[model samples]
Target chain A: MMAVTVITIVLQRNLFSVVVLAGIYSFLMATVLLALDAVDVAMTEASVGAGISTVLLLGALHLCGGEEAKPLHRPWLPLGVALVIVGALVYGTFALPEFSDPLAPFRTHVIPRYLEQALAETGVPNVVTAVLASYRGYDTLGEVVVVFTAGIGVIALLRRVPRREEER
Target chain B: MKRQMVLRVVGKLFIPYMLLFALYVQFHGDFGPGGGFQAGVIAAAAIILYALIFGLPAARRLAPDPIVEAMVALGVLLFAGVGVAGIVLGGNYLDYFVLDGDPVAGQHRGIFWVEAGVGITVTGVMLKIFYMFAGRGRSLDER
Candidate 1:
């Protein structure tokens, strides 16, 4: 279902529809998360990915050309690079720990301690919150910076109205 | 504007509560799976919903340019200021012990203030970007 929407996003020419398609994509991603028994992740994905990101992307679309982005040039270099990445990812999937493996090495690592003491340390019931706020606070801080930078970058890129051309 | 009474009334009823819930999410991130980013977006969305229903001009009026600009600097400053406090208290960056007389309490305090900072900046950017979008000559209202 989502694949159709995403492919439509890529293939369609209407920029507004593209934003709508991205919004649908987020909803689908949230559903996928719920199917995997990751309730908290699904919730966060729905709230953040669907709600905020869709708004931002739509707003950006409005500020710029509200038209489907046209490719600059059909270059095979980027296509080849993307193909290589997809190939590598497919190859790597074979080595992945079987889904729901109780004895997976990843399940028995430092996460156990973090999970055990997460509430005591941060007073948060949702382990994801504890890890994000306390255990990996630095990364969250970095994430904030990244968002800030993206806003700045977007404004800088779009505010180019050729200085010499006076306004009405 | 569509004179559909339901959307107009529902938007009026829902916006205030949505803003309140956003604040709650921002402060209660420690106890839940939400934080500054989510809260800011929710708050921005509420305002956006208002714009979508009431009018874009009204929304832009509610949040002006200067407010958005100040918020950007304030968020980054607040985040860095907490780290400075930690440095002054003989610890590494963002140590949070220096925020208050007590270190543990200070960590909580530090996290709260920093997250609030993040929320402010995010909300500001969202509103500002929306304003820019709505201000464009895409619609008939803007001359």
Candidate 2:
């Protein structure tokens, strides 16, 4: 189903339908994440990917118009490059540890400390929160700064448009 | 969109719950599967829904441009302030262990503030981006 959605999106020329299909793709991805037991990730995906992005895309669509432009020519070079990159990624995955492997490097070395000591250290039952907000507080702070920076950048770029353009 | 009565009613009904759920996710994150980032996005989505149904002007009126812009900076300040507080309390930067006499309690307090900061910034940024996109190409009077 995910593949079908992607194919349809690639083939479709209507930007509006493409945006809606993209939202559906995000919903399907969120469901997959939930089934994998990554509930935190699933929630983020559902809200950010499906909900917020869908709205943002529509707003953008209003500016750019609804029809995708026709390609100038067939793109055999780009397709071959994409296929090669996909093949490389698939080959690289074979070297990764098996799913849920008990002896995975982090599972043995890093995860035990968090699982065993998180409650005592942070008094938080949710290890994810403890890890994100306490153990890795600095990293999260950096993430927030990045978000702040992006917001500033957008405001600087977009707000500069002369309001008098309406008069023209 | 202005004449779509069904959309307007359904949106009004759903928006309150979305905002409420965003708050729930923000505070309940310590014990549940959500956190500030998710909550912030959810809240922004609620506002975006209102904009879609009722028109952008009403949404802007509800969440004024200046206030929303301020939020983007304010949240980062809050998060950084928490770390500064740790230093002032004689702990290392971001050292929650010394925020209170009890290290665990300090951790709790620190996480709460940090998450709040994150939530605020995210909500602001999302809304600001939405406003920029939606308000593009509009007249000054319309904006």
Candidate 3:
């Protein structure tokens, strides 16, 4: 389902349909995350990727028109780069431990400690929350700052400046 | 402007529930599959839905840009303030153990405020991006 959505998005010439398809793809990806028991990640993907991005893209379509322009130059170089990157990533994945292996490095790491001590230390029942907001507070703080920066960037780019009398 | 009675009615019925759910996700994050980031996005999504139905001007009226921008800054301050509080209390940066006399209570207090800060900032960023995109090309005169 996700692959089909991506293919359709690539083939479609209408920007509006592409945006809608992208939203569908995000939703499918979110469902996949849910299947993996990553409910928190699924929620974020559904909201930010599907909900917010769809609206933003639609708004952009309203300004730029709905039809996509044909490319003036060949995309061979970029396509080759993309394929090479995908190959490298796939090769790298081969070295990963089997899914959910009990003896995996990750499983042998601090996770057990986190699971046992999070409630006592952070007083939060949800370990993810404890880790995100308490144990790894600085990382989350940085993420918030990044979001803030993106907002500032968008405002700077799109906000209209008032006309002065002499300029008008 | 011709307003769709059905959409307006349904939207009116739905918007409150959406807002309520966002709040639930925000405060109930500690106990469930949610946190400040998810809650903030959900809250911003509610406003975006409102904008879709009632129009941008109305949404802007409900959450003015200045207030939204302030929320962005204030959330960071709240997060940093909690950390700074730890420092002032003779603990390391973001050391929630020293937030209160009871170390566990201090962690609770620190996480709560930090999460609140994240929620506020996320909400502000989402709405700000929406406003910027939606406002482009469509002048107020058109409305």
Candidate 4:
């Protein structure tokens, strides 16, 4: 289903349809993540990817118009770059541990401690939340700061600046 | 918007549930699959839906510019403040151990506050971005 959506998005010229297809793709991706037992990630993907992005893109489309413009140049060079990146990613995946492998390096290192001690340590049943909020909090802080920075940047760039006479 | 009776009615029915779900996601993160980030976006979506149905001016009146702007900064500060609180309490920065007498309780408190901060920031930013994009069309027309 996701592949079909992607194909449709790529072939379709209507930007509006592409945006709707992208939302469908995100829902499929969320389902895949849920199947992998990453419920938290799946939820995030569904909301951020399928929900908020669709709205934001539609707003942008309203501003810029809904028709996909014709490209002036051939797409061969970009296609080559994309294929090379895909190859590299596929090659890198080969080195990854098998699905849910208990003895994977990451699983062996901190997973044991987090699983065994998270309840005692944080009293949180959700190990993902415990890890995200308590165990690796600094990273979450950094993420929040990043979000804050992005918000500031967007407001500065997009909000109407005061007219010069008003400033004076 | 006034002419779209179906949309307005449906939006009114759905907005409350959306807002309620966002809060549920926010507070239930400790035991569930959601957290501040998801909750924030959900809450913002409620307001965005209102904007879509009733028009942007109404939504802006509901959320207000100053409060949304303040939320963006306040969430970041709340997260950092919790870190500083740890330092002040004689633990390392970002340490939840010293947040309360019982380390586990402290951990709970710390995570709750941090998640709240994250939710606030996320909700603010999402709304701000939406407003900017949606309002651009009107501003252009006015100019």
Q: Report the Cα interface RMSD of each model, rounded to 1 decimal.
A: 3.4, 1.2, 2.4, 2.0
Best by DockQ: 2
TM-score of each: 0.82, 0.95, 0.95, 0.95
lDDT per residue, candidate 3, A1-168, as tens digits? 788898898999999899999999999999999999999999999999999989988988887889889999999999999999999999999999998889999887989999999998888999999999988899999998898888889878767531221132
lDDT of 3 by residue, B10-129 (tens): 889999998999999989999999999999999999999999999888999999999999998899999999999999999999999998899999999899999999999999999998
lDDT of 1 by residue, A76-167 (tens): 99989999999999999999899888778988887888888765654456676666655676887787787778667756654444222324
For each candidate, report its DockQ versus the true two-chain complex.
0.41, 0.79, 0.69, 0.72
- Give the range of the ten consecutive residues with the poorest summed lDDT in model 3 chain A: A159-168
lDDT by residue (B11-120, candidate 2, tens digit) is 88999999999999999999998998989999999998898889888999999999999999999999999999999999999999888899899999999999999999
Give the C-alpha miss distance for residue B61 in model 4, angstroms: 0.8
- The all-Cα superposition gives candidate 3 an RMSD in Å to the true structure of 2.2
Compute the lDDT of residue A137 as modeled in candidate 4. Answer: 96
Order candidates by lDDT, high to low: 4, 2, 3, 1
Residues forming the 10-long window of minimal summed lDDT in candidate 2 chain B: B134-143
Which candidate leads the pack in lDDT?
Answer: 4
- Report clashes for each candidate as comma-separated counts: 0, 0, 0, 0
> What C-alpha lDDT does candidate 2 achieve relative to the native structure?
0.91
- lDDT per residue for candidate 2 within A57-107, as digits (tens), equals 887777778999889999999999999999999999999999899998878
> Second chain of candidate 1: TM-score?
0.90
| Residue pairs in clash, model 4 | none
Report residue B95 deviation for candidate 1 (angstroms).
Answer: 1.7
* Fnat for each model: 0.29, 0.84, 0.84, 0.84
